[model samples]
Target: MKITFLGTGTSLGIPIIGSKHPVCLSKNSKDKRLRSSILIEKDQKNFLIDCGPDFRYQMLRSNHERLNAIFITHEHQDHIGGLDDVRPINFNMNQPIPIYGLRRVIENLKKRFFYIFSKNKKSNVSKISVYELDDYKNFFIVENYKIFPLLTWHGQLPILGFRIENFAYITDASHIPFQTIQRLKGINILVLNILRKEMKHSFPFMLSETLKITQQICPQKTYLTHISHTFGFHEEIEKQLPKDVYLAYDKLIIYE
Candidate 1:
């Protein structure tokens, strides 16, 4: 299986608009990140996790030709903002893309993108089929591939993480249930989120919190995403992490 870090920054992304923060001003490409998202490939099937506002550019840069399905972690605008940008793929595939999310998230999308959901939509509009995921039920994207949805929390909002084979992808998660951690024990490769070195909000994990959880989950390797400028320069801060931990940057790819 292969995984691509399409984008690795937090909601506002790195180099937030109108800011002169040094990390944002840095010339290193690693310091310049788009909103957090990833693309996963297993066998010949492709799956996208979190299509943020930067989705179009991410896909173009990576030159990924096809996506079999989309999985949403939550209903936040940063994660779902690029839902409309799937039109080109829809046109190329000549079919509706399948997207999986929680019931509330599905409802949110229908309201936010009412035009796309409208019964009499234009022929040129993007097309997608929505699937509601039950927090307690595992589902399959295909006959051979099973996707296990691991429930997590973003403050008070319930969100989801996923386990496919020995690999897992999770982001924008604050509190992870004990059952979820039990399920994730000994994962091979984990893509988890860490907003910054310290926590200023209750909705996401900080470096310390994520690291503690990492130890608990015992993944062979952990790639941290959903970063912010305050997390420090990529090259320097990354060097400080444990041997198996890494700060994932935009466009980075890995295999498991």
Candidate 2:
């Protein structure tokens, strides 16, 4: 299996338009981030997680042949805004891409992308197929992968994380339900969101809070994502993390 970090920044992304933060002013490529997302490649098939506003750029950088499916974490705009960009791929493949997400999230996608589902509407002729998933009821399986959806909390809003084989990816989780924790046992490579160094917000898990959760999960290696400028420069933050934990940067790749 191969995993690629498409974009590792927070909702607003690292440079946040015109802010004068030092981290934002840095010229280092690692300091430059787009939005949070990833691409998983296995058996020549590509699976995407969170098609944020930077989806087009991400795809150009990914260089993958085609997409098999997209797994959404929630309905936040930063997570789904660039969904329309999939049309080109649709035209090339001559089929609608399958989108898997929670029932509530899928419904919200309809409202946000209403034109796509409407007939006789003047808009891009994009096509999509949605699959409403019950993460609590059963594990999802597709092609050569068996995916286990783990329920996580983004503040009070319930969200999902996925476990495939020995690798698990969980982003924007403020808390992990006990049942979900039970499912994560023995995961080798784990990805979790750690917003910044400070434990200021209850919505996004900060560095310390995320570390606590990492200790509990005890994966062989943990890569932190969904970073903010407040987290400091990528070069500096990379050194502070505990052994086996890493700060993921855009375009970073992992093989398993």
Candidate 3:
């Protein structure tokens, strides 16, 4: 399996509008993050997680040719804003993209992108099929990839994090339930969201809280994503974290 960090910044992304923060102004390309999103590839099939607002640009930059499915964590605008851009892929690939998420998320997509869900809509529009998911469900999405859903809390919203093979990816999660923590044990790689040094947002984790959780989970490697400019320079933050933890940047790819 191969995991690609398509984008690792928060809702506003790094280098927020009109801000002259040093991290924002840095010339390092890694510092210039888009919104948080990721792609998982197993065999020849591709599964995208959280098609955020920067989805189009990220796809173009990565030269993505096709997407087999989309897994949503929640219904936040930043995550779903780029849903419409999947049109070209659908047209070119000549197939409907399977979308998996919670029931509420499916409902939100139907209402938000009414044209796609319209019963008598034109055929040219992208075809998207929805599959509602539940926490703790373990099932095969593709021939070789079996996924387990881990239910977590992002403030009031119920976010569905995923465990694929040896990797666990969770974002926009504020608190993971005790049962989910049990499922996350023995992960080779774990990715969690840490918006800023502190907990100012309804979603995302406080740095200290995340560190404590990591210590307990004890994954082989733990990388933090969904970061904001407030998290400070990547190199500086890297100095503070333990050797096993890392700050993920856009375009980082991992394979096992």
* lDDT by residue (tens digit), candidate 2, 51-93: 9999999999887647889999999988999898999889878
Cα RMSD (angstroms) for every candidate in the order listed: 1.2, 1.2, 1.5
| Residue 162 in model 1: lDDT | 89
Clashing pairs in 2: none
Steric clashes per prediction: 0, 0, 0
lDDT (C-alpha) at residue 64 in model 3: 92
Taken over the whole model, the C-alpha lDDT of each candidate is 0.91, 0.90, 0.87
| Residue 12 error, candidate 2, Å | 0.7
Best by lDDT: 1
Write one digit per residue (lDDT tens) for candidate 3, span 1-256: 8889999998899889999999989888878889999998888888899988899998999889699889899899888889888988897799888989998999999999899999898766768889988645565465457878889998987888888877999998889898889888999999998978964666678798789888888899998999889888898888899888999999999885
Candidate that beats the other on lDDT, 1 or 3, i.e. the better one: 1
Model 2 off-target regions past 4 Å? 121-123
- Candidates 2 and 3 compared: the better one by TM-score is 2
**What lDDT, from 0 to 1, does candidate 1 have?**
0.91
Of candidate 2, the 10-residue stretch with the lowest lDDT total is 135-144
- CA displacement after TM-score superposition, residue 73 of candidate 1 (Å): 0.6
Ranking, lDDT, top scorer first: 1, 2, 3
Q: How does each model score on TM-score?
A: 0.97, 0.97, 0.95
